[model samples]
Target: MVLTLVRYIREKGMKPGDKLPSIRTFATELGVSQSQVRSGCLRAAAMGVLKIVPRSGCYLADVTLSGIIGPFTLLFEAMYMNVQPPLIDLYELKTTLERGIAKRVAVIRTIEDLAELKRLLDAMETATEHAEMVRLDELFHEKLASSTRNPLFFSLMQVIHSMLRQSRLSYKDFVSEFPQSRKDHRALYEALRDQDALKAGDIAEQHSNRRKLLLVKNY
Candidate 1:
């Protein structure tokens, strides 16, 4: 159903903020029951594909990493509550994925990508509030993933970041390592700028290990 809606949007060339057909109209057009259309729309909303506005109408959401990972955000929340192993496993998975992403990003990243990464890095270094720093940190990683030019990598990183955000408050102590993290990001960015995939991978491993240590100490 979500795929159906996404296809519909694509076929219609609807941009973000473009109004969607009313539920009844969509149902009739799609030859589905109104209930099914509503369900599909709600699911798409959960996945960040559609926005539902009360007293208004549904619209296409901006195609963003956050929106793409919205359903995973909900899934990770449930896993965090009901399953312990999955949370740990998710960290391991992210570690493996990001190392590869870092290497690929290094080889493929554009000048514009480096500029955005540097911008985020600067924001992180100067951020006085813990929350703002954390937000910038997430954005920095997201930008790195985007530099890889792999939509799957970007989407997965978005999900992992969202899941980590669920427990960020409890891990405030990790913010104490912000200075070191900033240095690591700078090194990683330089490695990427140099287009040295091997160096990028090594930096990624070091960065991931440091983060794992922080999680171990804090958790």
Candidate 2:
């Protein structure tokens, strides 16, 4: 039901914050019971795809190409696959992506890109909460991917970051080394600032491997 509602919203060309049709309208057009439509709306809202207001109608949540990746991944797992990708597989793919991002971003990054990355790192320094630290770290790498001026790269990194977030929650012993990670981010930022492609690539790989070790060791 949730998937059906999602498809209906997409088919209607609805965007984030746009109001969906009335439940009665949806039920009549979709040939579903009103109760089903209500349930579907509730389910979709739970998935972060819809926003239900007490007095107003359901609205689409903030939409992004990256935001849809999580749903697609789960749909694939439930419909076509038996299990999620192993941690090692996710690490390998992310490491490769980071290596490539470092190589290109070092050469392609503009002054503005560097500044944004530096800004994220500076925020990391002042961040007091664990969740804030993790969110900033995600944005840091997302900036690296975006600095490459490749939409594909940025979208892929977002999905990987999402998956890694879930993985982190599952690994009870996978404590974060935010301090060391921040230092690595500083080095990466410097490498990009210097336009040192080779050094940036190396540091990116090393950083990925360090996390890989921590994850597996704790697993």
Candidate 3:
């Protein structure tokens, strides 16, 4: 049941804020009980895919960049493909989430959280290879999401980040050859350490958008 709507959304490339069919309508279309469709809708809403407005019909929620990753990943895997469009879409989503998270982190990060971020950077430095770098990178974002003290934030981030990681091979070569990105990461860490929210957010968004542009240009 949950899988059905998820697959439908992925197939349709349904953007955030699109309206979904009503429970009765969808169930009739699927030849299932309305209760089943309603239950599925509830689950999808919980997963941040759909929103049920009290006075209005159900509509797609403004899902975070991280939230759409899982479906993108599934789309990639199922089709045995990674394409430019999904990559660009995912990057845009990450840009949105990172900026928002940066604002919160600027205000909310604790000393311990900053220390942990440094520790993640240290692990990233020691990773010493692409596979290890990817692993450490995931940990870094996951840890950042935790520092925000918002579970929903982390949940969306994990999905979005995971999507990017899974499709990274599509653009890894272009990104890997850039010497400046390594330096940028360090600079980003320093900004976070200082709790410089605006700087950090700007840097994060720029970093994501740059990659998206590069990927589009080269791949």
Residue 63 accuracy (lDDT) in model 2: 59
Q: Per-candidate RMSD vs. true structure? A: 7.0, 7.4, 8.6
Candidate 1 has which clashing residue pairs, if any?
none
Which candidate's TM-score is highest?
1
Clashes of 1: 0
- Between prediction 2 and prediction 3, which has the larger TM-score? 2
Candidate 2 lDDT over 41-136, as tens digits, reads 997777678999999999999957666666655553444245565778778988999999999999988989988998999898898766677688
Runs of candidate 3 exceeding 4 Å displacement: 1-85, 170-175
* Per-model TM against the reference: 0.65, 0.63, 0.62
Taken over the whole model, the C-alpha lDDT of each candidate is 0.81, 0.83, 0.73
The residue-level lDDT of candidate 1 at 104 comes to 91
- Lowest summed lDDT window (length 10), candidate 1: 78-87
> lDDT tens digits, residues 18-124, model 3?
88877888888788899988888887777678889886878878887667666545544445354433777777887788778876887788889888888877766
In order of TM-score, best first, we have 1, 2, 3
